[model samples]
Target: MSHTFDASVLREYDIRGIIGQTLGPDDARAIGRSFATLLREAGGETVAIGYDGRMSSPMLEHALCEGLTSGGCNVVRIGLGPTPMLYYAEASSEEIDGGIQITGSHNPPNYNGFKMVFQGRPFFGADIQKLGKIAEEGVWSSGSGEVTERDVMGAYVERLLEGLSGVDVGELADLKVGWDAGNGAAGPALERLAEKLPGEHHLLFTQVDGHFPNHHPDPTVEANLADLRALVAEKKLDFGVAFDGDGDRIGAIDGEGRVIWGDQLLMIYAEDVLKNHAGATIIADVKASRALFDHVAALGGEPLMWKTGHSLIKSKMKETGSPLAGEMSGHVFFADEYYGFDDALYAGVRLIAATARLGQSVTELREAMPAMLNTPEMRFQVDESRKFAAIAEVSERLKTSPGPDVEDVNATDGVRVTTKDGWWLLRASNTQDVLVARAESETKGGLERLMAQIDEQLSLSGLERGESVGH
Candidate 1:
């Protein structure tokens, strides 16, 4: 019964791979049996499972169920939905103790993966590695556990509407907004949400087409938001919101067709959240704009910067009891009155509520932010063996002599260097064989200086910036 997985599919955060080559039914079943064993050992029996709209999802789901039942782990199949719906099924229930979502999550159509939650916490990093180890060792419990289906789509939509609870409906009467689901798993949920939401709504590609016939589902890339911006502009809507493939990350556009990066969106969310939970801690990844950290401080809230990766951020939120947290990559978590999971659908609803509560348009909120010149996240390939070592090399050099302008060096995740001009970050991507770099400064000259510093460090490590790599 021993099975060895394609090593590449076992990632730091989740199990993911190109469909036919690195991952398939065998891997899915291994994951299921291994996960079930872990859950049962922890005194938990029920596991919730859901799948995205990807073409291969159903097949994987069926095989996954077989493995789960074989291990004596009861399975609650929530059917096809976004990753958050599965999160909801697990979080909103006392009966379920763990969950797994079959989602590629903004990756290309040919890719698929699994995101898991154990007990109430993110099952990642060491947990993921352990799952792989258990699979390879072929140690699994045996029993026949029942499988049943539960429809939570309607309840999930209703739960999202709660984000707009306190807002005045009259203020929303004339509001016109645009939505682009990008044909991912969030499409159907978005449709149901829009019908119940107040205001005029224009939806683009709400049909769940795994092919992504329109634009790519990822909203973090500005190019992918072209259709969303056009929809907002043509309809003259108040604003627009977009979702990644599995609906865990969010991207937004203002009424003026300006793309609001993830950090800027966090600024708005921080203000709204701070209004209620004054002096609460708000967390963002190191890659977030300095403006966001500054804004949180200016609003009289404590701002904490932490490592990237959704699982890491979620754990930090629990540790600090942070009400809200976000990543520059568009993953936002709200623990104030909801579960502490990144839910883009809920974020969209909060955007509407934030506008109404703040008494300003989305564009106005965006316009008020400090103007900072920043580079789009730059990723360059490095040998998998060299990625983390390269970052350590850079950190070591900075620690020895950070130069005059360098204010401080934070190595929370990787190494983030702060200079009087601004800040720059160089970290190894947890899930990829690449180094991610981002720099931000108030002036164009300052930005250039910051970028130069980045290059100098890379050159010191015997590595050039090289051609940029795609996500």
Candidate 2:
């Protein structure tokens, strides 16, 4: 059967779209066929499949299985779980030749997509574009391949819990915790971990609902964290935790209802790991706070700033043999004593273990970190075709009329200018038609100045500097 897919559905990172609209069973099947064919051509024989808790995932999984089997690749369905579980399965199973995760990954619940890995490397960028072209041209090779169902959840949970065996959680005996899963795929995994944890645990939205009857599953957005915050405050809980749609990223609120951004979480995790792996390399994306890098350096660990993207960060980690790496979006990769995959469940366990060892509350740990005022990620809409050009314009302007005594300028991801007071970054989004900007300083006034610098640059690029643009 011939199937058609919108060329735009194939994204730089993965295939994603709103179900029944840009995506459906047919698209899933076609994607499965194309992906399977790509894998087979790359010498892959078996592929692992897993899905999130979205209502559409099960049907999508079945359709994808049909396509994979028809494309001459055996499918090992790992049933329902987070994207990380699929990554774990691929890393642990020797028979598996590749894997595909059916997940929207913190996007709206109605959205669903795939994250593919072939031959142990992320199958992204040009590979994803190729799949779309194949589907559009109705190019698929036919072969008879078998399909098998497997219950890897039990083993998956066992591996996760087993990694925590040495961690001491005794200090958390008196801690009162609130967990909000936002009805994503992480609910079950968080519930399982809660059962084994020692504390007064309260769960919100633990049931899986693809409709996302509550707020969106993206915890990084401050608005999405409102419910978790209220719950923490109402219960006077020690801390609150939330997960993204696929459970690979995590968000947390201290006892005082303060959001501990991912960079802060990385600081805490870095300190813990540095003790064991002294002088080890720790990586964080350029979007992360400077404080995280400073903290890592102060703790005697090498801090490396790299490009944004989970797959990009993972590849850098492997190249540098970094023990830990995290993105501001909450994707935490731990290669110290575990597989170098971003697993929020494992991150939570580590956080719990670290707090227990500190004998202090989550708020206390936040207080210990250096204080810096940071603007929330500001995103402004731009024509998809003009986004990169805008960035280039700003870069050229900065190069010609450089700011006063700019200490350093890093254009690794975009333009990150560091001055005496603070730093500011402006980058074009890879997934959307938006320009992202962020500024940070030790003082509020300095932050404003840094933002003003960004505004001037934007103005030079013929971009409007309005509040609606978000500063």
Candidate 3:
């Protein structure tokens, strides 16, 4: 039997699409076969496979393992878990040559995808495209290999808790936490953590339901965080945290129901990290608030701005030997005390510990951070094909403009124009068909001026702007 995989589903980062429409068992099997062939050609013999709590995951995993075994690749199935757990399994296990995590991440329930690692590096972009071509060609190597199922959840949980020794959460007995797993793969792991931690724990959406019957798994958007916010307030908890579908990223709410964004959370984490590793390098993506970068520098750490993408950030972390790196979307990587993978569950423990040590409320700590008027991530509709070219155009135009106030124009990821008032950024999102823009200023009028500048430049690109001012 032959099958055709949609080329469009082979994205820059991973193979993703609407489950039934663009992806199915056949697609999964083909991907597994192609991926195993690629790895085997690269001298691989074993592969680790894991999946999130999505309802379709079991079927996909079964098909994928079948394909893997058929392709002469031994498969180690780790069952249901978060993307980070898959990553951890790959990183720690010497038995596997590569790994794949079947997860939709922060996308809607209808969406399902894969996060792959081959030869210890992210298998993405051109690699993902190549996989599609292989599937399209309907040519793959076949061999007989064996499959084995293992439950690594217990070991994973133990590793996560053991890392908390560096964090003194004051016995955890006096702590109170409310967690909204958003019905993600993190529910089971979080339930285990709750039992081990010395806090009064309240869990929401503990059941793993791929439908996401309660709310979307994306916690970055404020709308998706309503349940967490409400739970925190109703329970009068110390703090609240929510995870995306695969649990690589995190969104948090303070006791006061304030949404502490990823950048802000980084600020709090960096304070402690910097104390131990003075003058250390800390990386944040271009979309992160200027406050985070500035704060890192103020605390005697070097701040580096880099491109967006978890793979890109992890590469930067390894290159710079940075102990920590994060994106504005809540993907926090900690090489400080743990492996340099984004683990929301581990990040939660660090967050709570940081707050406890400060002896200040999460809201209070956030309030103490430098005050600068800023705008939330403002996304404008754009053709996915044109978004990058449009950003390149903007970068080119900014280079020719004349002014000393234009301190610097950085095009590492997009056009980040630095002026005396503050800084503004316009970048093309790698994951979606949108042009994302953000601005911050020391003063209100300064912020307005920055927005106006961005708007003027966006107009040149024939894109519409919306009211995303004053975050």
Candidate 4:
């Protein structure tokens, strides 16, 4: 049987769509068949499969398994867990050849998707397109392969707990922390983790509800962290940490109810990692604050500014031999002592360890960082066909503009322009039909200047700075 996916489902990063519309069991089966065929042709047979708590995940998982076995690839089904657990299964197990995670990630309940890892590396971009071609060809492996179930939660939890070894056990008793899973798939594992943790823990919405009753699973949105902030305040906890739907990205707030962005978290993690691996490379997405890069350099580590996207960052980390990397959206990767994949749970534990080892409270660390005012990531709709063109136009204008310095323009990803006031970034969103822009500066006036420049450039491109953008 052959299947052709809706063009929108095969996104730049993963396969995602509104369920029952752009995605269904049939598409899942086709994906399974195509992915299995790819693995088999690569001289591999076993594919590890896992799913989130989304309502549609179970059916899709079953259908995907059917296709995999039909395509002559054995399947190892590690039922409900976060995406990182599936990554652990693939990375730690020698027998596994590939992995597929059925998670819509931070998308809404009505949406569902797949994140694939071939061997131990992320499978995306061109690899995702290859699945489309294989499905269209109807040329799949011809044999029935076996399927088996394995429970890796205990091992995964234990592996996470191992991160606490560097922490002083005496400090654990003095620590009080809050965690909000936001009813994502990370709930059960979180419950298990809290039980073994050393500090006093308060957890909210630890139940896995695909509906996300409390708030959206995306922690990147400041509003989504309101519950966490209130929890930290009510309990007078040292800090709070929250996770995205699939438990890959993280959101954190300090004791003072201030958000610690992805780059800020990296600053802490870099200090800890650099203590042991000096001169190691640390990577962050272009959207991160310049203060983070400066912090890495101050700590005797090489700092790399790369494009946004978890898969893209992971690939860059491997290429640069970077021990650590993170994204502004809360995707933190640690190859220092763990697999390079982003694991919010592990990141939380490391945060705890970083604080204890560095002899600073999370609040102190947050306060110690260089202060910069920056606009939140502003995403505004542009015609899909015109987004890249708009960015190109802006870049071209900035390059030849007859104005002051025009500062420096880096076209890696989109275009990030650096100026005396600070830096402003304009890039086309990889996953949406929108342009993402952000500007940062040391002073309020400087920040305004950067925003003005951004507005001026957008005006030149026949685009508005932005309209109301939420969600």
Candidate 5:
């Protein structure tokens, strides 16, 4: 039978929507049928699936399993866990050909969605759009495939611990750190990880609760990190690391309770990863700080700036053979000694190991970074039809006029303009009807000038930087 999905749920990266209203079991079933058909056609027979702690997750998972089996795809149910655990199960298995994780990924409790992997590669972009077409066409393969449950959490935790393989045990023993799971899907995995970790660990909200009782699970927003900062301060821990709802993205605080932003975290990872793989190519999103690129270059590694989005970055990592890559949104990917997927839990372990190996505390590493003034990612809602056009308009204007002090324009994903004062970025968010803007500078006056350029660009596009939009 033909199925129709809410157009909004078919996003650039994953299928997502507010529960009941924009999405339901029918859509999940349709997705399962469509995805399974695709996998089978690509010479795959089995698909691994997992879900988060959301109240509606189990229902969706069951429906999805029904659809998968009907489409002649065996289902390996990994039960409740973070997205990375599902990735781990899929990546570590020789029999599993694809995986899907039912997760909202730092969104509100009312929201839920799915992230998929196909043949060990990200299943997104046109692949995500193809699901909608297949569902509408009602061309799913037919069979009653088997379904079985598997517990991969223990094995997943063991793999994460490998991030600290070479670090001195004595140094890790002296470490004291705080972790705030924020009552998201990462809670159970975090608990299991903390138990095995040698450092004195203090955890907050490790009990999985999709309602996000303590605070929001998104660590990118400083406001959501308040609880984590307080925990670090109250306990006098060495530092703190937090996971987003599905534990694919990370947010961290130093010993002094200073927020170590995503790009800053990459600087640390780059330094550590560069030791053995000197002159390796390191990748970061266009939104990352210039300091990170400069730092990577200083460390004798090639710095590559890429478009944002985890799937895009992961694909790029494979294309370029990059050992490590990160985004300003805290999605860190390590292919050095592990699978090239974003795993916040593994990133936290690497943070511990990096500090130990770098011969510096997290606070000291933060202190070593160059001080640059920057604005938090500024997101303003725009009409979906107007978002990309606005960026295009800005790019077209810069090509001809380029105004004063415009040095270079890199339109990799959007337009990043470099000027003497600093640089500013204007891009349309692929997942939402919003235009994202950010600016950075070494001097306060320079930062103000860079921000003005952003405002000027927006004005030229007949748009004002209006009320900030929430992710």
Candidate 6:
């Protein structure tokens, strides 16, 4: 049977949609058939599957399994959990060849999606688009493959606990931290984990309610972190850590209710990681703070800045054999002693481990970092056909003019220019029809200068930098 999917449902990293409207059970079946076909082509026969706590996940999981078994692949259903648990199931087992997780990530309740892994690496980009092509061709292999269920939550929790290595386990009980799951899929796993972890741990919204009555699961947007902050303050906790809907990305706050951004967390992680693997190449997305890069270099490690997608960073990490990598949006990947996938839960564990090993409080770590002023990601809707071209024009103009105080320009992802004030970045978003901009500087006046430079560059590109931009 031939099938087709909405073009919008197929994204750069995963298949996502607004449930009922952009996707449903039929699309799930098509995904399963296409994924199984891709695996069969590579001489693989077994597949692992997992889903989140989204209300619609189970329905999609059932339909997806039907398609996978029909396409000559045995299915190992790993039950409900986070996206990384699906990754763990696929990677930790010898019999499993691939995996997919039904999760909506940080989208609203009406939304749901799927994250896939083939063999042991991330399956995304052109691989996702290929799923559409396979569904269209109706070339799926026919066979009645077996299906079985496995409870992986216990094992997944144990693996996350492994991130606490290199630190005293007794110190954990003395650590007081607040956790907010925000009623996302991480709720159950968080509840299970907190019980075994040593600490005076207070949890918020651990109930797996897809309705998200407490707050939106996206921890990156500062507004969504209000509840977590309140909890940390009320309990006088040492720090706080939060998770996105599917638990792949992380967000944190210090004991004083200050948010520790993704790049800053990378700095903390890097300090500990560097001690073990000195002179290693540490990777961060181009959007990260200049301080992070500088700090990595200071720690006797090579700092490499790359593009902004998790999949792109993972691919780059594989190509460069980097032990640690992260993005501004809180996706942290560690290949030091674990699978190189972005796992927020594991990151949270490591944060504790890092603090204990470094003999500093989370608040102290925050206070020790360099202070810089910067804009939150300024995303402005742009015509898809014109966005890339607009960046290209800016990159070319920077090359010839090399505006005031401009020290150098790097067009790695889009256009990143360094100056005495600091740096500015302009890039077209990979997932949306928007252009993202960010600038940083040491002082308030310097920040203004950097912003003006960004404005000047956007003006030259026939685009206006105004209050119209949305993050």
* Model 6 poorest ten-residue lDDT run: 462-471
Off by over 4 Å in 1: none
What TM-score does candidate 4 get on C-alpha atoms?
0.98
- TM-scores for all candidates: the values are 0.99, 0.95, 0.95, 0.98, 0.99, 0.98
Global lDDT of each candidate: 0.94, 0.86, 0.86, 0.93, 0.94, 0.91
Q: Compared with the true structure, what per-residue lDDT tens digits does model 5 show for residues 214-267?
A: 888899999998988988899899999999999999999999999999999999
Q: lDDT tens string, model 4, 86-201?
A: 99999999999999999999988999999999978899999999999999888887789999999999999999998888677777898999999999999999999999999799
Shift of residue 462 alpha carbon in model 6, Å: 1.7
List runs of model 2 lying over 4 Å from the truth: 1-4, 169-171, 466-471
274 Cα displacement, candidate 5 (Å) = 0.4
Each candidate: RMSD? 0.8, 2.0, 2.4, 1.1, 0.8, 1.3
Clashing residue pairs in candidate 4 are: none
**Clashing residue pairs in candidate 2 (N, C-alpha, C atoms within 3 angstroms):** none
Model 5, TM vs. native = 0.99
For residue 437, model 3's alpha carbon misses the true position, in angstroms, by 1.2
Ranking by lDDT: 5, 1, 4, 6, 3, 2
Better of 2 and 5 by lDDT: 5
Q: What TM value does model 3 have?
A: 0.95
Worst 10 residues of 5 by lDDT: 165-174
> What does candidate 2's lDDT look like per residue over 93-195, in tens digits?
8999999999988777677899998878778888888887777777787788888888877677777776465656565678788888899888887787788
